[model samples]
Target: MATRISSSFRGLILLSFFAYLCLCAHEAEETTETQHHHQISHTIPVISLIPSNACTSSAKGSERKASLEVIHKYGPCFQSKNYDEKVPNHLEILLQDQARVNSIHSRLSKEYSDNNKSRDSQVATLPATSGLPIGTGNYIVTVGLGTPKNDLKLIFDTGSDLTWTQCEPCARSCYSQVDPIFDPSKSTSYSKISCNSSECSQLISATGKPTTLLLYLRLRIRYKYGDGSFTIGDFSKDRLTITTEDVLDNFLFGCGQDNEGLFKGAAGLLGLGRNQISIVKQAAQKYGQFFSYCLPSTSDSKGHLTFGNGGVSSTVKFTALQTLSQSQSFYGLDLIGLSVGGTQLSIPKSAFSQEPSSIPARLSKVCLAFAGNRNETSIGIIGNTQQRELEVVYDVAGERIGFGKGGCR
Candidate 1:
């Protein structure tokens, strides 16, 4: 009986020992898993927040703004040459502009003659110039491109649709630029648009190229300015960095290989037109299709280009955008009359038609002209003149332009 009781007690002790071992092993396994999970969590990379994207979310579909500094090309701060040297340069630019204007008028006339019957009777007359700055003396904005970001100062052109810059491996030609040429090879995000793409097809059609050629060749874009300046290059997609921190991905732009003309020190051109390919259109999703700018009187004073409602204020005077069948790219304004210091001018309403080839006296120097010296011609320009005096708002949603005076000095 004593041996049986001792054997039973030994069996119970053995059972307890085995159960304790199993429990310890299970605990060890769970601890190892927890440590492994912690290791993985530390190894993973965290995504950094994008300012523009953050703003978009925080606004809850409300208005968001992105501000850009306006660079005055020939302002006193940017003048590198003497006044005498600038005179000849200005005259040369004016001549080129005159030629360009004549070419546009001739082309329009030919088009009218060819398709006048087929076209609508209400076909709007093309403007002499699209109120864009003609010469190198204009405004520019700094933009960063590529993965790591290569900064390029580009001209802000309201009349143009394609934004472009000189690129590397210039097998064809590239002019001397103030900044280093952008190298696509260095950018991981840079990509060439396939010929099969719709964008490429549209580009080919716009360039008057046969659609059949697209199947055999890559897409290329060519832009010719009124000043006789031209750029032809590949259509590509890349990242555009604005304000040094705000990044916009999959941005379409031209990579110029064969570039010529009066770019001055600018690396490229930023198209702000009402085209599908324009910068404003591309960023409309985030910016609400609204933009405004305040041009400073002096180059030393900093001006700004604001996306969304940054420049809007209570004092702005709104005007309806004129409907024109000729082109939707140009921002057309109806000029019923002109007032000078609260005095209305006696100029005929017809004189303000067709972008006014020449502004009458009293209205002199008030309208902005593409070419010619400001003194030789009274051609007024609202680009730098009015922009310098007021805050100009391009409200695409409202289909109107707003001018707020006393915003800039």
Candidate 2:
């Protein structure tokens, strides 16, 4: 019995020693962790992590990752019961600390994206369209051409072919509102067709008025900003200077003209529609064969226009209607098929008008008219009433139509 008691006492003593050793080991570990935290705090203060502005929702994820990355690379300055909840108090502070290197990287990223998008747009012309009238026929816009006499922009149009702006032969002083008339005297390449020139004759407005030229394209733009309108002062023979991804050359344009109430910047107009030998056509001949324009939508007030190659994106299907004979140029289309999203739509042949009066004199001129808005005497006035109901797109790459407009608001 005495021997057993002694053995039990010995066993108790050993167990106590073991427990004491474990306690010492745990204390040592705690001290080591504390020392590591202190070292990190000295290296990078927590105050350096906050941004000047409050973090936006987008930055939250990035901020979290960045904070963790810093900790991983250099150890953390603070301790948390749970590692997942560890976060810095500020993000801008971190950015400021790394400002010099960070800014350079950010700028390079932006530039790369811009360059990529421009190149893609230029190469996508097979599926895109020029916002300008590249072919022949008729097209119209509510243009406010600035008058050289009064500098008043005027707006009236027919989807025809020709470009001329109001110029200085007016009964009144022509320079009151317009910028100094385009002085062809300035450009080495300026050439004038006589007032009786055939090109000028073709410019006869549907209203039977004579077309006039004031300033032709050079390499300058004269702006009159009082009425949300402006003008390009440079007109040239089949050449235009525009900022683009491609090296554009030899385009033509009407430097400026006075139209009535069409734009918001100046007293001039750019003859961009599919009129004869206008600025847009000249540029296409010299650059890429196509361009595109996306008008402002209610959801997105600003859109884009691309010439040449366009971007690749998922396409909504569409039904192509038979293009009117006049649907050849300026603004024309060959209606072949139509689809919405992925569904095809059928259009009745009766939807087309066969009456000579209902049809435009020109075979390629497609008339956009309302069912009840047809004027017995009017030739090709596309009724504005129906513009809101349909989205029109033209496939000119095919055999039926060469020009197109619509699918924009």
Candidate 3:
């Protein structure tokens, strides 16, 4: 009987020790308990095991500036009529993420030697019925569209340029969404663009194709994403509300009449890319073409998407930004150095790169949020999983990208 009690007490002690380690890993800089491992060559960075901002919610920079909460699509905050929809497993998420990355490589080939002259064959062509961007990942942000301002959940994407949503009178077909399909007829400010407008000409640069004309000479667009998804719809302008006070009049967007893709029940997507049609460019005058975001670390936790430079953090480290020659929408950076824990890894600077998840107890079930490239020439993509807790700033007017650690909202 005494032996049984001793064994049970030992089990409890082991469990308590594990719990303590987890708490320290997330909440504190160092653990009171020591760890010894045979395989590791150097000490693991305990400080980086779990970000300090996990599950924390706060607002910083610009009370009047436009900042919105970003939530995981699979998290508790997302509202959907279809509760029966199956949540994707971690493997499914990895596959979807890989597909999105592959599409990016297809759209922008890695070989930079040839002067980008007839690169259409190497590209993922978007016919009217052909494309919708990416896997949409796990995070989504809600936005107000139209004059009366109907709230729409959109996956804000830095790789895309056109902001679009599923619209009413689904002339052909529309996907199921978390919010009501935006009815343009009900909005007083909705207006369609003409096929001959200069804005329509810009569509060629944005989507890799010319705008098609509808029956009334109204412009229509067809966009194809790298992940084998596509949207076909009317090109129109309306009042876009970032916050109650921050609104953009005559905001251009795609009213997806025939939309098909894995948007994960989002109404649509908001483009934060660098082209003239992107929200970042359209709001250049008011927001100074400056925007920053910090993706949250966990599925249930929340981060933020902030526009304009008001009340900006002083700690952000700036790096030069270079546009990819293959696609103007994609951004490239020079990855000259890498540091893990407190020590810098001795990697070569000329290994030359063009482009760059969750928690578990025992840490056994944890999956890597990063995907490996097929070849050295394959274009590497930096997904939200890597951007989690990173304060990423896009200084378009200043022509740089900045990063700071431990950033969350």
Candidate 4:
């Protein structure tokens, strides 16, 4: 009897040892895979915190308010500033708008002169189709008017409000940022809209300008340095090209002035917002109801952008966030919960202030109050000032949820 018992015990021990080995192997495999896909750029010094339920747990009425205070006292929002130096830099709203319009008009005027003044006959360049396939969520879309259409490299921006590109109009003497400008003459589909048209007047109204303003399109325009400094030229009825199985016809886009020459080479911007005829909305109006984006993990240092029905990826689970649609389309996630390590972050909805301003103005400059932390969440923008798409992806990448730059009420 004793000999039989010993044999059984040895067999059990061997089985347990094998199971343990298998578990360790599985864990190591997971770690290796994660390491292979990780992307790290400039190190973001972060404050380590133990999450708390007092802040993260859902509360009702007055109890919720008290829980938020406890969260602010202990949450990372208090210590986040110590780690991230890119605090939100708020700019006055009026000043920003003024800078945008001024930049556009000045550059457009120059491009007109340069193009029309060229005495020699020159063949316009044709646009080359970008061979990249649109990824599931994040992708870049280049738009232009003609053959060799000055291809504008545009990051489809959801977090930003104003969508413009660099232009030859302003290139007259400004710092050359990107590549050559988009020319309309070569495009067989290009058609210009009159300044007297109702559409022109409507565009002015949205920008806080008068109806008399002459609006033109350049290949690109950008909002930079806390101002609306854009480079634009004349508009055209161009059939925007896309790589999709569906028929895409009669797409409206602008031809940037190649004369001013200020662009750093980005083609132009494709605005995605709630406005009447912005890029994303226009596509959604014609295509499907859902539009998604995926930012390559900045940790990897490389990413792609996609648009239209063709741009959806299966890699990451998408958590649809709330969005504000006042001045433009802004993304948001329900402030249902926040966890810092093991601790939950407590924030009060009462502290949030929702106001109408440029999307960029809100995200990087607004100040909101946190419990123990006087001001929390200094949102900073990353990537090209021309890349509005990166902003949305950045916001989504971090533990920080919601969109817009502002202070708690």
- All candidates: CA RMSD in angstroms? 28.8, 33.0, 13.4, 22.8
lDDT of each prediction vs. the true structure? 0.52, 0.26, 0.60, 0.30
Per-residue lDDT value at 200 in model 4: 54
**Model 1 C-alpha lDDT versus the unseen true structure:** 0.52
lDDT of 2 at 6: 10
Whole-structure CA lDDT of model 3? 0.60
Q: Against the true structure, candidate 4 has what lDDT?
A: 0.30
- Model 2 per-residue lDDT tens digits across residues 268-314: 33343443444445455542334333222221121223334333122
Residues 1-409, model 4: lDDT tens digits = 0111110000000000000000000001111111111111222212111233322211121121111111121223223232322211124222322233232233323434544443321111211111111100122344443443454445454433334444444434333323354445555665665665655544443333333345333212223321222333444445554432332344444444432322222345465543434554445555433333322221112233334333232223333333322112334332223334434344453433444352235353343212111222211111221221121221222322211111111
| lDDT score for residue 35 of model 3 | 27
Tens digits of per-residue lDDT, candidate 3, 1-409, equal 0111110000000000000100000011222333221111222233433333234454552242689887766655565566334566556655555554454555455323223443433222332111323335456788899989999988777766778888988887787777889999999999988766776667655555423332237776666654356777888999999898899999999888887664747788788777788999999999999988766666556778899986566777776666655555555554432344434355442343334322334763444433446664455444444455767788888977777765674
Clash count per candidate = 4, 86, 8, 69
lDDT comparison, 1 vs 2, better candidate: 1
TM-score of 4: 0.43
lDDT (Cα, 0-100) at 221 in candidate 1:
66
Q: Candidate 4 — which residues are off by over 4 angstroms?
A: 1-145, 148-150, 161-163, 166-179, 196-198, 201-205, 208-228, 244-250, 253-263, 298-302, 308-326, 340-409
Residue lDDT tens for model 1, 1-409: 0111110000000000000000000001111111100000011111210111111011211232477676455443343332212322536645544443444344334434544343321111222221223344356677899988998878776555567789887867776666788999999999988788877654543333455545644666666544445677778889998765467898888888877754656777787767667787878887777887665444444466677765367777776654333344556553332344444355432343543434455742243433322232111222233245356777877887776754443
Error of 3 at 256 (Å): 0.7
All candidates' TM-scores? 0.66, 0.34, 0.74, 0.43
